[model samples]
Target: MSQTRSSAVFGKRKEPHTIIIAHGDDIRHFTVRPWMAALCGSVLAAIAIGYLLATSYLVLRDDLIGATVARQARLQQAYEDRISALRTQVDRITSRQLLDQRLMESKVAELLDRQEELSERNGRMLPLLEKAAGASAGSADIPIPSAKPEVRADIAPANAYAASAVTNSAVAALARITKGSTAGKAGSASIADRADLMFLTINKSLREIESRQLEKIRTLTENAYKTADTIVAALESAGLEIDATYGSSDAGGPLVPVTGAESFDSEVEELDEALSKLDSVRDAATKMPIANPAPGRVVTSGFGVRRDPLIGKPAFHAGIDFRASIGLPVHATGTGTVSKAGWNGGYGRMVEIDHGDGLTTRFAHLSEIKVTEGQAIEVGQLLGLAGSSGRSTGPHIHYEIRRDDKPLNPVKFLKAGKAIGTLL
Candidate 1:
């Protein structure tokens, strides 16, 4: 084999590597270089290493991805928590601001309600104030509210409410109504203070109004008393006693201690009491027989001891004689029912009227009696025709006023009528 290999190499150094394989009917020779075989082995080893590395990477990929995802989730949760905390703080602040706004609005609304109440009270006091003002302006002549009550006619409570002036509180409340809840943080306190001041002013005005109204009511009550006293004096001067009463009341109840603004309400209550009392007095006075029976009449015979015309001697005159033409109408002196419309022995064709409170009047010397017995008559109504009848000196109406069957002087009532134009 060596002698053949050397002889083959000496003849040709370019030796082709060969492999001879024998088959049943064929023989084939294959040749390859050492470098080629090394190349094939190196390729196979690289492929095997690459396959193992790929399989290992596949096995670790899920765990690596899971760790990364978990870390990211933790970071995301932290960020979300921070964001939520911030949002909560903002919400809390907003809620607090909303609560403040609600409180402010509630305060404003309460103030408005108080202003409205004060305004309503002011309205209710207007008529009394007007009456008082008018009466005061007209008269230093009229001594007091009770002296000449005719100036202030009986006014209805409904007519009492009228606008005299727009108060500061009312204006402020009206302005605040348009500026609802728009106040800034610093402005909110300022608004509240201003509202309080306005409320104070309103309360002050109400107090003043109540005071004035109470004064007027006092005046009215005093006037009523004066009028009643005057009437009583007039009746007493004529020896007539009528049942009457003037009350002196002491107020007592649950004593509530008032302070600061609360006194305004108390004053208002007093004013209401005064008004009620004045109203009651007016009602009572309206029913009394305190007016003149004859207006624009000439008194010929005074009520006192006078010379009897028939006897021509000194005699006591029970009544005043009003000289009038025969057939002239004679008026009733007071409101009453006709008790007798027939002739008496001394007073022929006389018409007698029985006034309330045990009071009566006689129209004597009448040609004809217009009012029948049991017929109701008002003061100044035509009772009969004046004529010279039995016990009459001439054609005249012998007007007699009697209380409890006792004759009273008619001059006092006539003077009262002159003093009070309305009663006349």
Candidate 2:
């Protein structure tokens, strides 16, 4: 086999190897060509390279695994940090929202309190306003505003839970709206802001109402004063001097100018004073026999100078003659005590009442006498029935007002009565 291998090696392009195996007396021979040898060598080389590479990998396996693990750990740490940052940002946003909500709630509560106060004030002024309206002769009635508060509680949430309970989609929508533009933020109003504005408006309206009330009271006071002055003038014109100390005693003090901002209390006080004065004047005027004795009766003959119905000649008439029907109900024109109730010559069935302040009223030609002598009588009280008794030519009444036993024209008193009746 050595000699055959040595001879085969001498050939170059025709290189071939023979393998001979001897065992006992049997021999086996195999031929190996160059291509076959090369194939086997390539196969062996591939197997050797695989073994070396596997060995190298096995030697540095710890480093490779360590690098892989380190890289994975770094990635995990980065992800954790990002998650923590996101969580912190969410916490900050939630805290800020909570703070803003608390502030808004406080503002809403304060506004509600103000609204309640204004409502109460309006309620208190309602009666006074109604009184002013009644006293006004011809004016629009002042209407009281509704007492109910205009602000609603649901406009602003009372607690943080209400805000927190909002869904994510709703929160996002709100954020979009709030952050849309700077102009939107400036121009738009929140629920709390709207509530505050309503309260302010209500307060302003209440102030205006109070001012109107003051003005009404002032007007009423002026009217009352004017009415009193007119009554006094009428009394003086009819030769009746009013007592200087009629209502309140004369008061003197430094004249303090009234300020522009008049209070309701102050205006109401002035009105009451004026009303008292008016009442006193009216009372004095009524006692002076200024009221008509027979209202709605036609005066057939006026007092002073008239042709006598019986004589048909010029005569000085002491009283006005009213053409009244027989048995017509007659009322006392003034409050006084009956001094005479029996028949008198030329004054048939006369009823006389002596009022204080030296004033007396006489009703003659009565069909029936109801009041007795010394009986108390008030204005508009039933005195007797009308009839053409003795002096009267027909069914008529002779109404006379006398001061200090001197006859005065009854037309003057009746005219004064008509003028003062409007105020009363």
TM-scores for all predictions:
0.58, 0.59
Number of backbone collisions per candidate, in order?
2, 0
Tens-place lDDT digits, model 2, residues 1-424: 4333235665634336679988999999898878898999999999999999999999999999999999999999999999999999677665654554564455445445544543444444454444444334422122222442222122122211222222222334444433432232223335335434544554455455445545545666666676677777777676666676544566799977665334545766777777677667766776777777778889988888777777889999998888899999999987899999989888999999999777889999899999999999888899999998877778988999888899988777777767656544
Model 1 vs truth, CA RMSD: 10.2
Go through the candidates in order and give each one's C-alpha lDDT: 0.63, 0.68
User: What is the per-residue lDDT of model 1 for residues 337-424, given as tens digits with 9 covering 90 to 100?
Assistant: 8899998978999998877777777888889988789998876788878899887778887887777898887777666445443321
TM-score of 2: 0.59
In candidate 1, which residue ranges exceed 4 Å CA deviation? Answer: 1-100, 115-245, 248-290, 420-424
Model 1 TM-score, 2 decimals:
0.58
C-alpha positional error of residue 423 in candidate 2 after TM-score superposition, expressed in Å: 2.3
Clashing pairs in 2: none
